[model samples]
Structures are given as structure tokens and as C-alpha cells.
Target: MNPLSRIRNFSIIAHIDHGKSTLADCLIQTCGAISEREMTQQVMDTMDIEKERGITIKAQSVRLSYQYQNETYILNLIDTPGHVDFSYEVSRSLASCEGALLVVDASQGVEAQTIANVYIALENNLEILPVLNKIDLPAANPERVIEEIEQTIGLECNQPLCVSAKTRLGIRELLERIIMQVPPPKGDPNAPTKALIYDSWFDNYLGALALVRVKEGAIKKGQRILVMGSNKNHEVLGLLYPHPIKQQQTEEIACGEIGIVILGLKSVTDIAVGDTMTDFKNPTKEAISGFEPAKPFVFAGIYPIETDKFEDLRDALDKLKLNDSSLTYEPETSIALGFGFRIGFLGLLHMEVIKERLEREFDLSLIATAPTVVYRITQTDGSTINIQNPSELPPEQKIAKIEEPYVKATIIVPSEFLGNIITLLNHRRGIQEKMEYLHETRVLLEYLIPTNEIVMDFYDKLKSCTKGYASFDYEPYEYREGDLVKLDVRVAGEIVDALSIIVPKSKSYDRGKELVVAMKEIIPRQLFEVAIQASIGNKIIARETVKSMGKNVTAKCYGGDITRKRKLLEKQKEGKKRMKSIGKVNLPQEAFLAVLKID
Candidate 1:
């Protein structure tokens, strides 16, 4: 094995569909980490959903051996997702590296996420090597992209390494540059053992496996280690180097190396990401600093389609949470939806991925309610509480004010779509913060938008209006006071907790009307009329009726006495009124999803 100075730890960062994963494939192949026959596109993306969508969901790490300047050098590469929802994964990957390959699509130039990821890499103090990918395309404009990267992001990149991941062009030079430019890891091998847990997952055979980057000393097989955060001691049963094809087992993971530590533990919660692992006998003095836990920005209710599958859903979530620490959930029961859970996610995409995984991996059918943002409610008594579910909202008279989460959004688009983009932002109640032209053809816009505005279909609307040419990214800014009201949806005069939402007071009427109208189209008609009403506190804002399935009792009276027929009709009307008063409305899965299309 090479010394610490010969090992280079780096990650590839870029915007969505910018070829980050493809570039990783090129690197892995060039270093011969796996045989040519075993090579496949996007080898880092092991999940079926990831492969189907062509996106990296979880951050993946692999160790490769390369011969650079007559010496075998170890390269630890972490491939990170580019979507804004997966930014947490990118940040975690960046923490375990010393450098990053800023992969920018040659034709797309600088985008919103490109700048956002650069700031993260800069914060980690990683040496950034700008690389222009997909340069073989006919639309590839390397010179223009280079200029945009310098002007928009202000990176010192007059001469960036241009490469085409598809054609394997300029790949060798990339590897050489990584070895020369990226500095070696710095830590003492003789000091007490210290390793940072960047990622972890549960395995049926080995239990929970933690992928860590050793900072000091060494972690050996059968070594007792203490988790600094949990303050628990566990023995390291094995060590292995990460590879795309298969992990290679080893006896010891030395200092300044990246490897997986097997603790043979069944519970994944026992090991947390960002926790420090050290020798139990000679432990490190301090835990790693600047470690912030992942915070979920969107909340929604996830209920099993079959009421009996609630336990299966819970178990699935527990296993999923082991793979993704950002996901959170708690037992929540709804009068309308029965037993379920309120799950928290980083964004809408995260929510969708989780829902799909539960159905596909755990084989549990689920119905996910419309996504909503958290609101801080201040009562008349001067006490404050944060609530994510609309059903948990206090009464209007009891609440003094409500504050919603806000985000600083960055959008990069062509100059021609500026008007459409601005109009869309204005419609969503956004406040313009800044505007600058990256070049004559590209414009950058920044806005302060309420998180609730973009929780549902805002991204879809933006993409549609801009003709799919816009790149967007956002970060949590602050909580601001807003005129917000909880809009409740009622079926048969009974409130449905899963169908409620916290909307702005100004648009409450329109939103409520649209919601009830949408619900009316999905709710199945019963023997009696089903009243679909949207209300604010005690006041009804909008109402729609799913008319009863008509069955005439008068039809049974064939050409008999007119008085007898009238009496039969009157009795039928009385029965209908009584049925409406005692009947229950069954809401389909689409009724809960209707809230997303209310806008």
C-alpha cells in the first residue's frame, strides 16, 4: 500500500444531469478498479430507482489504485448527487475529501447548483479542480463555459481541464492532475485512532456497515472503539475497502485512508453519520466540529393503502432510515386515514423517492399526502409552537401570529425567459433580492420565497414556463411573519386531517375553492349527498357537493293513484335526508393528492 502522501481523496460535484456519474465511470475505468467486462454505466448508482431515473440518490465512495509516475497511488473518490434535494448527501461526501472535481456540462455552462456546490466545497476547504465534461457534443462551448465559471462563480480557472466522459477524452490527464494538485491527507498514524463516519447502511448478513475516512491512528480487526457522539463501545469485526464491483476485505484500515468498518450491530441507530470513532483505550480528546445534522424541510403523511400494513410500513421506514439519515418519521394516526406516520424529508424529491422505495422494496402500498412546510405559531399568551401538520394548528382566535419558513432561491436562465420567470416568482409571492447577467445570453436571479410556495408544483411550473432551460437551487434563509391560515377540508361535515393545508390568508379563499372543487371530482358518490367543504376555523370559505347516486322510489309506482304516488315521493325524500345526516364519505387516494393540483 502507498503512504498517506500518495493517497488523494476527492469528490465529483455538479448540477443535475451534468454528467457527474458518467465522469465517475470514466475515472473508475481508467484506473482499472474493475475489469472491462464488469464495467457498466453509473456503477456508483446501485439502487433500481437511481438507475431508472439516471440520478445518484445516495453518496457513494470507492477506493481505486492508479499508477502515477511509476508509483501506485490510492484514489478515494466519492460520487455525490447534484439535485438540490440531495444537497445533504453532497455535503456529507465533501466532508470526507480533501479536493473536488467541479464537473460542469460544457454546453450548459454555469448553473444555479454549480455555484451552490462550489460554496459548499469552499466551506470544506477542498481544493477544487474545474473540469468541463461532455465536450464532444456538437453544442459543446468550452470557451464560453470557462468564461461563465470565472465571471459567475469567480473561480481562478483560466485553463480548466476539458474532457468528454462519453468518449473517454482527456481522462488520463484528469487522473494525473488529481494526483498532483490534490494534496495528501494530513494525520498522525501513531496517534490515538480517530475516524469520521461519513456514511452507513444496514446489511442483512453483516448488520450495519459504516464507511469512514480515518483521520488518525489505525482501526484494526477485533479492535474496541468508542463512538464519541453516542458514547458507546463496540468491537470492529472487520475492515474493507469500498469498490464498485465488490468490496475488498482487509485486516486494518490505516491512517488517512477510506474504508468500511463492520461492527456487527443489528440496529442502525446505534451508529450516526458525522460521529467520531476512536480507540476505546486511547480515545481522541475532541469530536469533530462543524457537524450539523440533516434537517427535513418538507412534511407529509404517509399511510398504508391496506390498514393492516401499518406495521410493515414502520419497519420499512426503519430500514430506509438506516440508509438515509435525513429521513424522519413518527407514529401519527388520522381519523380519516387510520393508522399512519408523519414523515419529514429534505424536499419533495426526497419524499417521492422514499415513497417509491417503500412500495418497491418493502412491498407496501402507500398514499402520501400533499407536502407542506413547517409554521411557527405564536399564541395570545406569548407562547410559540412549531407545527408541520395543519391538523395540529391552533384555533384562529387563540393564535396571535404565524410564521412560515423562507428560502433564498437562486435561478439561472436564458435572457429571453426573464419575463416569464419573474412573473412566476411574483405569482408565488417572491421578493426579488438581486439580479445580474452572467453573460449577454444568461441571467441570474435571486429571490426570497416562502418555502410553502415551492413545496408542491412550483418547480414543475418553473420548468414548464422556462421551457426546461432554468436551473434552480435554494437554501433555508429564515422564518418570517406571514398572514397564514389553516385551510381545513371536510367531507360529510367531518374534518379530514390528511387533506388540510396551511396557506396564505390572501389566497385562502381561492385555494380553498380550488381544493374543494378538485376533491369533488375524486370523491365517490354515496347513497346520500357528500358535502365537500373547505373552511378556515369556524368560517366556511368554499363548498362543493358530490351529488347522491339517484334511485327513485317513485318509479316503483306504476300508473297508480296520483295521491299515493305523491305520498311515496314524500317518504323517499324523508329517507334521503336521514341518510345524508348519518352517512360516511369514503375518500379515495386521489382525494388526498388533489391538494397538490389546487394551484
Candidate 2:
């Protein structure tokens, strides 16, 4: 086992497309961790969905051995996601590291997520190392970027490492700098075994595997370990160092090292993320603290397109939960969409990724309802409850007040689009907090906005207004009392619970109208007229109708008495009335998506 002084545990943090994963690939190649023939681009992103989306959803860890001065030093590199949706993943990665490489694009000086990650790293007390990536590009401006980082983020930039990850420039020097600049992990090897499980996943052959950082002591093969979170003890069946190509099996994971622990359990639920694992016989004094669980920001109902696929959907979610602990779901039946599950996600991107995975991985066609934020409701009896779906909202007369989640959003855009962006934010009920000019061309704006306002199309709008130049990031701030009411959509005079949403009272009229109009274009015309109405507690606020298909019954009675033609038309009307009473509208999948499309 290597001593604490020879080990460096660090992570890569940056905004999306700033080249975190690519730099990781270069580092892995530089250290000879994987053969050139076996190496692939972004090898750390294992999931097909991640590779297809070109984003990192889960934080990945690899142990690299670097030889310098005739001595081998072990560098545990944790590559984290750059998107705001996966900031929780970054936070978890930071908690397990002593230092972080803050990668900023040489062209795009400082973005929103770069600032957000710096704050997270600072909170974790990680030594921040500034690196200017993509220096080979034509737009590269190292001197300007260096000045911006120092001025905007206030990070030291006296001697920033400038390199192009794609071209492999200055990679060897960057590796050397890591050894010289980053501090070694501090821990006692003689203390009792104490490890923090930052990540865990279900393996087909290995059952449940936990990727952990040994904080205080050693974890050995065949040793009994206690999971402090669940208060359960299990025997360690195997130990392996995490690698992109292949995990190297080890007899022990010593202090100041990271490795995977294999417990012969059939399900991932047997263990939990952020749990403290220690020696069963010689337990630690306290469990690892300061590990906050991932809190879901958006909630939506996902149902299988086919009713019989309900069980299949359940099975798929069960397997998926093994990999993603941030995902939460519970069985719920919708009157309009039938049996489904109400799932919670960190953000819209997370929702989209999970939905895509369910379809691509499990071969299940699914429909997701409009996403909503959790609302804290106070009842007339002085009781309070938190709800994600509008269907779960209590009766209007029984409620006292409602509080909606708010977020502190950071947006960085070019100066030319600042006015348009500010106008857009104001429309979403955003209150300006601070605005600054990072330089002559770029502007950074901070605002407090309702979480629900940005849940659907706010990001898209921001991108359009800025001509795709805005970088946005947000974190949950607090819940504030909001004047909100639940808006219910009715098709053919029957409430469609899955299409319901909670919106601000001031915007309810416009939202209701917009919802009905959007639904009118999607709901197919039936044999009888279908009434689409939006209402708040039985008071109809907006209504639209899909005209019935015209059938000329009177044409059959040509040249007969006018009364005879009239009699035939009357009979047709009666038939239409009867059909309207019993006929059900088959809501297309787009009908569910329409709720998301409404502004």
C-alpha cells in the first residue's frame, strides 16, 4: 500500500464542452493507464446515452499510476459532469477529492457552470488549479481568459497551465504540475477502517459494487464491513481499483486510496450512496457527515404507451434505480394516461436522459407528462404537506397558502443580448439580484426566479434570445409563499389528471387559455364534438372545442318533402348526442407533450 504522501486525489470541474473528459483521456494516456489500441474517446463516459448526448451524467473515477523521479505516485482522478443538471454529481465527486482542476475554454473565458463549480469546490475546501484548455483553436486568447478568470471568478491566474486537450499540448507538463501543486491526501493508516461510498452501481456479475474512498484505514477482501447508513453488515467478496478499460483487482484498498467494494447482494438497495462503510468488528466513532442527498427539482408522471407494459416499466425503473440514486418514483394511476409512475428528477436534462434510457435500454415506449416543482401547502387546519403533482394537491377550501421552490440563476451572455435576456427573465417573474460586466463583450446576470418558470421552455427561450450564446446555471435557494393555484385540463368534460399543472394565480387565465388552445391542435377530431376546458376548482377559465366530423345524413333523402329531410337531420342529431355521451377521446401521446409545449 502506498503512503498518504504519495497519493493525490483530485477531480476535473468545468462547464460543458470545455473539455473535461477529453483532458481526462489525455491524462490517462500520458500515464499509460490504458493501451493506445484499447483507448477510446471519453472512455470515462461508459453509458451509450452519455456518449450520444455528449454529456457526463454520472461521475467516474480512475486510479492512475504516474512515475516521476524513479518513484511511482498514485493519482486518483474523478471526472465530474459539467452540466448544471448533474451538479450533484460534481458535489459528490468534490467531497471525495482534495483538489480540483478548473478547466476553462480559452475562447469562452468564464461561463456560468465554471463559476458554480468553483463555488462548490471552494465549499469543499478543494485546492483549485486553473487550467486554460483549447489553446490550439483559432479563437484561443489565453491572456484575455487569464485576466477574466482573475477578475470575474477571482481565482489566482499568475501562471495558468495553457494546453489543448484535443492536440495533446503541454499534457506532460500539466501532469507534473499536478504532482507539485496539489497536496497529498491526509489520513491515518493505523486507524479503524472508515470509507465513504461516493458512488455505487449494480453489476450483472458482481451484484452490488460501491466505489469508495478509504478515509481512515484499510478495507480488505473477505473482511466484514458495516454500512452505517443502513445499519447492516456484509462480507466483502472482492476489491478492485476503478479503471475505464478494466478494473484491477486488489487484495486491499489502503488509506488515501479509492477502490470498489463488492458485496454479494442481489440489489443496489442493499447499499446507499453517501453512506459510511467501516469495519464491522472495529467500527468508527461516527459516520461520515456533510454528504447531502440529491434533491429532485422537477416532478413528472411517466407512463407506458401500452397498459400491459406497466410491469415492464416497473422492472426497468428498478434496474435503473440501481445506477441512478437521484431518481425517485412511486406508482400512480392517471385517469387519462392510465397506470404510470410519478418520477422526480434533478432538472429537465436529467428527465430527458432518464426517459431516453428507459426507452433505449429497456425497450419500453413511454410518455412523460409536464414537469412540475414540489409545492409546500399549508392546510386550514394548520397542517402542511409537500406535493409534486397537481393531482395530489388538497382541496382548495382546505388549503391556507402555497409555497413554490425558487432558484438563484446565473446567466452569462454576450453584451448585445443583455437587454433581450433581461426582458425574458422579467417575463418569467425573475427579480434581478446583480448584474456585472465580466468584460466589454460578456455580461453576467444573477437573478432569483421561480423554479417552475424555467422548468419547461425558459432555457430554450434564453438560448434563442441570446442566439445560443448564453450560459446558464442555477441552484435551489428557498421556498417562498406564492400566489399559486392548480389548473386542471378537461377533455370531453372529464378531468385529465395527468395534464394538470400548478401555475401562478396571476397567470392562470392566460395559461388556461394557452393550454386549451394547444390541446385543441393536438387532440384528434372525433365523431362528436369534444370540449376542452381549463378550470381552477370547477370555475372554467378557458374552453375550446374540436368540431365533429360532418356527415350529410340529409343527402340520402333527396327531393323528398322538406319535413322528411328535417326528420332525417333530427335523427342524426339525436344519434350524435347519444354518441357524445358515451364516446371517449383517445388522447394521443402528443396531447401529454402539449402540456410541456405551452408557454
Candidate 3:
């Protein structure tokens, strides 16, 4: 194939609010992939949560045709999620691309996620094209940003494109750079089929639709192919590019081409991200490397507010798993929440997205349990067990030792808030690793802290302490030997074991106190007095009491008001339906979430 004819595959990557999706929309519109009148802002962000949250939660792809100097070229555009929590997803997106458009905010310069993304691009050996975005902002400093990019990324940019996606400035020049700098895909068109599954999703009518970049050989619809990773054969039923579906009778998909194939598979388990597909009859050694499945760091129990919607919740989770393979779930029975599923997620963002989708897409009312981290337990026999639920934790006698995961956190804050942020981190048992100046107005502080300490409301606390100017990024670090104790919550002196968690001793006092206070506000006043206590091995560290109240009744009732009294009782019954009865205390859904946070 001609070098120029080889299609160039690339994606736009940046931190949240850095204009990745906006740039995609502008590029697609300019390429005539979508009409200007029909164009929508952040077109790649198709999910409802993505729109409401103003962030891309899932990666999306589109194909475009760009003409530069009378040469028409095919550009496969992959839009990647910007959050660090979805770093695994971002890696899968990058695997499909040969080059990447690194968009950085001109005024904000470089962020933690921006640096992380640049490192990933470099690791993948992708040709990086630095583009300074938000150039129209009042604080725009393109020259300084270019210097920072070159110094930090160690890449020489010859006249880096400066553009405002909002204003459509310098977009044409960026397109020209893409054609000049990014090399087109190259592979043998006549070799046996070899393709990489960049992304896969379940289609209601078509089953599994895999977004693939044909790295080598040709593939045709109706051809029997085997996914080399699973060694399962599948028949391609349909083929599609970015637009309308085309007949599969054509010769075959050549190398360096991006397209979709319906593998007529029932479940998405057969085809996974980073897996390779090839012809079964004549197998090649060109199988694509697979990234390890992202382990869910947080676990929560999801229950239906309406008990009758139990099956509905299950179906919703099943559908969600089709799109997000990172989400894991299993049936769980809670004494307080009849029947539910213990759901696991990559991080808090992943959990939030799942919950939002269940509520919005499935239109189901849900009650979620407090999120917990998986604990590693060492038995008396020296065998290790990983426990996700407190109920699954071994009895105190059988466990020899236990360890919780830790994280190396990097927080960037304004100079003015450095003292406040440092104090907050210290309270959370964070040991200062280092602190350095990022710029005149900003500082980067590093700390080694337990994952459990920061998993709950840590982001919110950081924002509040920093006046919403601090940004944080964390990666899992090695666990260290520390004092670990199980903090349990008790109501009316009866231990609620489900609420118990293994926390570091250094953080137990403050965390316990905060939880008890929040629970007091959440747990409503009951007919019987209830005492809420946070304890460790029979030792109470914090306590709050809920005073008992008399029966709620009207002081006066007249003959005409008899009907009103009946209506009042009916409303009371309706309210009681929403509350979960634990002994004599009635707990609302908010109480569970309140206990999950530190403040």
C-alpha cells in the first residue's frame, strides 16, 4: 500500500474541561462527517451521564475524510475518557491509534492528567501532536505553555497549533499538521485476518459490535473468524464504518483501516478489550496484546427502593456490564436490604456512573450501600484471602493479620491554600512524601496514604479545603505494616456488623467521630430511643443518641377533620414504605450514604 494511502489512526486526549470532545466535534464537522447544521456540542459524548456531568465517561470513535492540498485522507478519530479513574479505558483507546492529539489548556498549562496522558502516549510509541487549546481565554499564554510542554514532555514542537475549538481558529492548520506529522497505518492486506478490538459494545439487535483496527490482512462479513484470545469462532453478520451500514460482499477490509464488525456472539465475554481476532483456518502470530482487566477498588450493595423491582435492577446491571466490562456484580442478601447485588467498580466515578445509569436509563429507584474497599486477610495457616464485603471477612480469631491497599497521591493546589490542604491530608494519616513548586502560583504536594482513608469524601474535602482550586490524582501503592482495627457501628447498643470496616488506627478517632455525627443527623427520631456508637473491639470511640418520640398525632380532631386524620395516617404509611426497619429504628436511604462519608 502507498505510504500516503495508509490511513492514519489517532485520538484526542486531554484532562477534563481541556476541550477534547469539543475538538472532536469541530474536526468531524470540518471533515464533512457531519453537517454543520446537524452538529451537536460534544457529539462524541453520547451517554446521558456524560452530558450532565460534562465529562466523557466512555470512549467513542468516528471516521472522517480530510482534504489537505487536494489530497483526500481517511482519519479515524477516537475520543478517550479524560478522568484518571478511567485510565485503563484510556489505554484501550490508545491501542487503536497510531498517533495522538495532545490538547492542553493554554491558560492552565499542564495538569496531572495531561502529564499522565503524555506519558501513556509516549509509552505506546504514538506520534504526539501538541495542540494548545483555549487560546482565546483572557489568561491564554501560548508561548509559555509551549515552553512548558516542551520542557515537561521533552518533545520539540515546530510551530505548535494554537486554536480555540469554541471559535474554530487554527483548526485548518491543526488538520494539516495531523496529515503531515501522523503516519498512516501500515499492514499487509492479503495476509490472514488480524484485528485489534479497541472497543466493544452490545447492540440490542446485532449482539456484540466490536470496534476494530485491522492491523494486518483482510476480513469480510459472513467470514468465519476466531478470536485468538478466547479461541472462539464467530461469523461476521454486518460491517459498518462511521455512517450507514454497507454490504459485506465487497472484497475485504485492508490493513490500517478502522471499522466495526458484528461477530454474532451472544455475550460480550467472548470478545474483550485488547483481544485479537483472526481467521481460524490459517492463524498468524500477530495476536494483539491484552490489557489486564481493571480490578474494582470499591464495592457497594445496590437495592431497589421498590422491592418488586429486584429483577429490574438485575437486568439493568446485566445491560450495563455489556457496555462496561470493568463493572462486576454478584447476588447479595442483606438483612436490612432484602435482596440486592454487591457491585464492584474501578473507582468512585465508575460507581457513580453505574448508579446514575440505573436510575436514568432503567428508571428504577435504588438504595446503595456504603462503598468499601477490598481487604486482604492472612489466615492462621498463612493463606491469603481477599474480602470485599464485611460479611465475608473471617472471624477475628481465624485471621492472623490483614492489610488494606494504599495510594501515592499527588495534589496540586494554589499557593494560598497549601497550609489548609496539608492540614487536611495530615488528618487523613497522609505522610508527606515531598512538596515542590509547579509554578509561581501553584504547588505539587505528594503523600503516601491508605486508599480507604481517601476513598470517601476525600475529593470533596480537598476541594473544600482548597476553595475548589486543588486537583488530585492517586495511584495504588504498596501496603505497609500499620495498626489496623475494625471500626463497627452500633445502634441501640446492637452492633451493625455490615457497617464495620478495617481502618488504620491513626485515622479511627477522627473518622469514627465524623461518621457518628453524620449518622445522628441521618437516622430519624424513632418511637424507641436509639444510641449510635462507633466502636473497635468492644471499645466505644464515639457515640450519639437518638431520643425517642411519642406517637405522631394531631392534638385536635373534629367531626369534619375525621377524613383529614385518615389522610394523615395514609401519608404516614406511604412514608413508612420508604424507610427500612432495623429493629424499632427506621433508617432512610440517605442514612446509609451519610455513614459512608467522613463529613
Candidate 4:
């Protein structure tokens, strides 16, 4: 094959809603990869959640052929997730690309995430081709955005391409630019077998499917290969490209090419991101440039509403883990919710995506406990255990010392909300680290706070305080000793173990009071009076009481007014029958969520 005719691998990257997906669709359409009628908005956003949320959650790949100056070039485009939660995934996607099309929203200019994406791309040594998108929008200002990109990102965007993806304007030119700028993969086809695992997922029928980008040599079907990182050997069953209709089996997948390998491996974890694939007979000691596994900072318990479907939940989680390597789960027994899994996630979005996938794909109703961070606790015997659940804490006497995870949080918000944001952070036991100005209107505030303080509803609270104009980014700093207390929630005099949390004293009152009120509204009126209390050890910080109900009348009437009163009594009796007799009131799923949300 002609080296110039070979495929050029690249990926589109940008902040959320910055037209990365839109540009991908335009590129595919302009390159005639898909039919014009099939050109849907955000075509790469195949997941329902991704489409609904107007953001790409999963990375998708597509193949396009562009005729640049009569030379046909294979353009392999990888679309990556834009959210900060999937930074690790983004990094993996970037590894597969030799170049990156940095799509910047002409109107919005450069966002914090854009900067992050550009930095990652540069770190990967990817040739950056900055493209300004959404040029048709009313607020589009390509020139100003290009200037900002140059100033902030320190890139020379001398003539950044301005294109309206919606109008199909300058799209062809952009494709031509990609062909000219991005270099074809450079690898020795005659060298020892070497490939990079850019992404992998499990297939129900074929087992583990790895999206491998061959960097050197050739990978052939029926060849025994070793997953360099795991030292595991597997036989390749087949190969596939982006063409959905057909599975193409070639004699060999040469250098600079992207294809899927059906390695009859039973487990998805065998082929990790950035792992090198080599022929088992001749292996190399060098490891691929793969990223470390993303550490999950937030932990939560997931339970099914129907106890009998616990196995279904487990199966669902198994399937989810195949696709999302970041989600970690282990069996846990809850005093209130029975057997479930204590799952760890990178962040709140990761947690929600897993839960949503479980419910949507498996059709199971789930109840999740409030998220908690891992706490390092030292026992009197000097043994340390990481406690993710408050209920796992040992007795006060047994605990010699406890340290909670802390993060250095950087929040960029409008200047007007600086005072309010600071006050809220202080309430959460956040100590001021530094405060700087991003621009005249934006303030960059940094704080070192306990991870547990910001794990639950803290993001929501921060957004609420900043009026949705703030962006928060955090990295784990270290675990530090803190003045923390366990806040136990009680309903009908029985403690709800799932509702308990360990929080700093400064924010305990507000958190406890808010949660108690939320529980009171959602716990339903039982036959007996229910008291909702938030207590720290022996002290009660807040309390709310749900009054018990009176007996329902169901007797018949004979006369006119007596008949009406009797009818009303009968209705009351029916209503009481509908109410769940948990000592007396009816509780629904909504109530459960309400209690969890403290709304």
C-alpha cells in the first residue's frame, strides 16, 4: 500500500456543546461516509443519554475518505467525551490519534475544559488543528475567539478555519486541511507485532472486543498474541472497522490502521487502555504509554427496589463494568437495604451514568445511598482500614485516629458571587488556599476541603450559589485529620443506616436539618407517629415529627346528609387501605428519592 494512501488517525476534542460532535457529523457527511439524508445532528452521540444531554458520554469512531487534490486519504475520526468526569477516557481516546481537531465555539471562545483538552492534546504530541465552529450562530465571533485562543492557549491560530457545521459551510475545506496537516501513522510493518489498546468493551457473543491501533508490524487472525501489560495470551477471532454492515477479516492489520480485534478473552480487564499487543513468541519489555487507572473518589451503595432482582442488578453492573472501567463495585450488606454493592465512581456524573444504565438497560428500579468518600481510620491496635460507609466505623473507643480525604478545589465563578461562594465553602470546613482573577468578570477561588464535605450535594449547592455560572475542578490533595462527626438519621425511632453520613461539624447542622425535613416530607404518614432526627453521637442537632393518622370510618348511611358523610368515610377507608401499613402510612418511590435529595 502507498504510504500516502494509508489512513490518518485523529480525534475531535472540545468542551461540552462546543460543536465537536456537530463537526464530526459534518465531516462524515462531506466526506460521503454516510448518506446526506442520514446526517443527523450529533450523529456520533449514539447513546440515548448522550443525545438527550446534548453531550458525548462515550467515545465513538467513524471512517471517512476525503479526496484532497485527487488523492484519496482515509480519515479515521475518533469522537471523545467532553465532560470533565471522563478525563481519563478522553486521554485514552487522544492516545489513538496522531492529530487532534480542537473545535472551539466561536461565540463561547475558550472554556476551562477546552484548555484542558488542548493541554492533553499537546501532551500527547498531537498536531493541533484549531477549528472554529458554530459560525452561523448569532453570537459567532471567530476572529475574537481565535485571538483569545492564541492569548490563553498560547497557540498560533493565524488563520483558524471558521466553519458553520449547520450550514455545511467551509466543511470541505476543513476536511482538506485535515488531510494536509495530520500525518499518516509512522511504524515499521516488518517489525515485531505492536498495537495500542485505545478502547475495549465486551461483546455478548464474541467476548472481549478491543479497538486496536496498529503502530508496528501486522496483527493477523488466529495469531496468538500477548497482552503486554497482563502477560495474557489470546487468539484473535476476527477484525472489524467502522462499517456497521459487514465484518472484514484481513490477512493482517498493518501500521497506521485502526481496527477492532475479537480476542477470545473472557474478561474485559485483560486488555487495558494503552496496553501494548505483541506476538506471544517474541515479546518486548517496553510498555505502551498508557494512563494509570482513574481512582474513584466517590462511593455509594446501590440497591434494587425489588429484593428478588438483586441478581439482575449484579448482572447489570457486570455488563456496565465491561464498558466503563472506571466504575468499581464490591458486594456490601446494608442493615436497612440488605445485600447490594458498594460502588466507587470518579465523580457524581459517573455514578449517575452507571445507575441510569442499570435502570434503563436492565429495567430494574434502584435505590442509591448518599455518596461518601473513603476515610482512613486507625484502630486502637494500629491497624488501618478504609471506611467508605459510616456504618462501618468502629466504636469510638476502638478508633485511635481518623483521617478523611481532602481535595484542592479550584472554582471559577462570576465575581459577584465570590463572597457567597466563600461563605458556603467555609461552612463546609473549606480553608482558603488562594483567590485569583481569571478575567475581570471571573474569579478563580481555591480551597482545601475534606472530600466528604463536598461529596454529597456539594456540586449542586455550589452551582446554586453561583447561579450556574461557575465551573469547579478538583484534584485529590491528601488525607488530613479533621473534626468530623457521624450524623445518624432516624425514622419512627428506628435509625435509617443508609441515611447516615460523616460530615464536618461546621456544616452538620444545615445538612442534618435539611435532610431531616426532606425525610419528614417523604417518609409517609404511618399508623404510628414517626420522628425524624439528626443526631451526632448522643446530641440531637435537628428533628422533625410526622404525626400519626386517625382511624378511618367505613360504615354505611341511610339518610341524605348521613349518606354523604358515610360515602366520605368509605373513601377515607379506601385511601387508608392504599396506604402502606408500616406502623401506618403509605410511602412511595418518590418519597424515597425526596428523602435522599432532602428536597
C-alpha lDDT score of every prediction, in listed order: 0.91, 0.92, 0.81, 0.80
What are the per-residue Cα lDDT tens digits for candidate 4 across 474-512? 768998987677888876556767778887776689988
Q: How does model 1 fare in lDDT?
A: 0.91
Q: Write one digit per residue (lDDT tens) for candidate 2, span 173-193.
A: 888888888899888899999
* Model 2, runs deviating above 4 Å: none
- Candidate 2: lDDT of 409? 98
Off by over 4 Å in 4: 2-6, 243-249, 414-420, 431-439, 443-449, 551-599
Error of 4 at 166 (Å): 1.1
TM-scores, each model vs. reference: 0.98, 0.98, 0.90, 0.88
Q: Which 10 residues in a row give candidate 2 its minimum summed lDDT?
A: 264-273
Model 1 worst lDDT window (10 residues): 287-296
Candidate 1 residue-wise lDDT, 1-599, digit = tens = 56899999999999999999999998999988878899888999999999999988988999998997789899999998888998877887898899999999999999999999999999999999999999999999988999999898888886699999999999999999999999999999999999999888888899999999999999999999999888999999999999977999999999999999999998767678788899999999998776677899999999999999999999899888878877889999999889999999999889889999999999988998888888999999999999988889987889999999999999999999999999999999999999999999999999999999999999999999999999999999999999988889988899898888888889999999999988888988888888989999889989999998988777777797899888987887899899888877778888888988778
Candidate 1 lDDT score at position 551: 81
Cα misplacement distance, residue 506 of candidate 3 (Å): 2.7
Report how far off residue 244 is in candidate 4 (Å): 6.0
Positional deviation of residue 116's Cα in model 3 after best superposition, in angstroms: 1.0
Superposed model 3: Cα runs more than 4 Å off: 1-4, 243-251, 550-583
lDDT, residue 32, model 3: 77
lDDT of 3 by residue, 368-446 (tens): 8778887888889899998888778777778888888888887778899999998888888899999877667778788
Give me the overall lDDT of model 2.
Answer: 0.92
Pairs that collide, model 2 = none
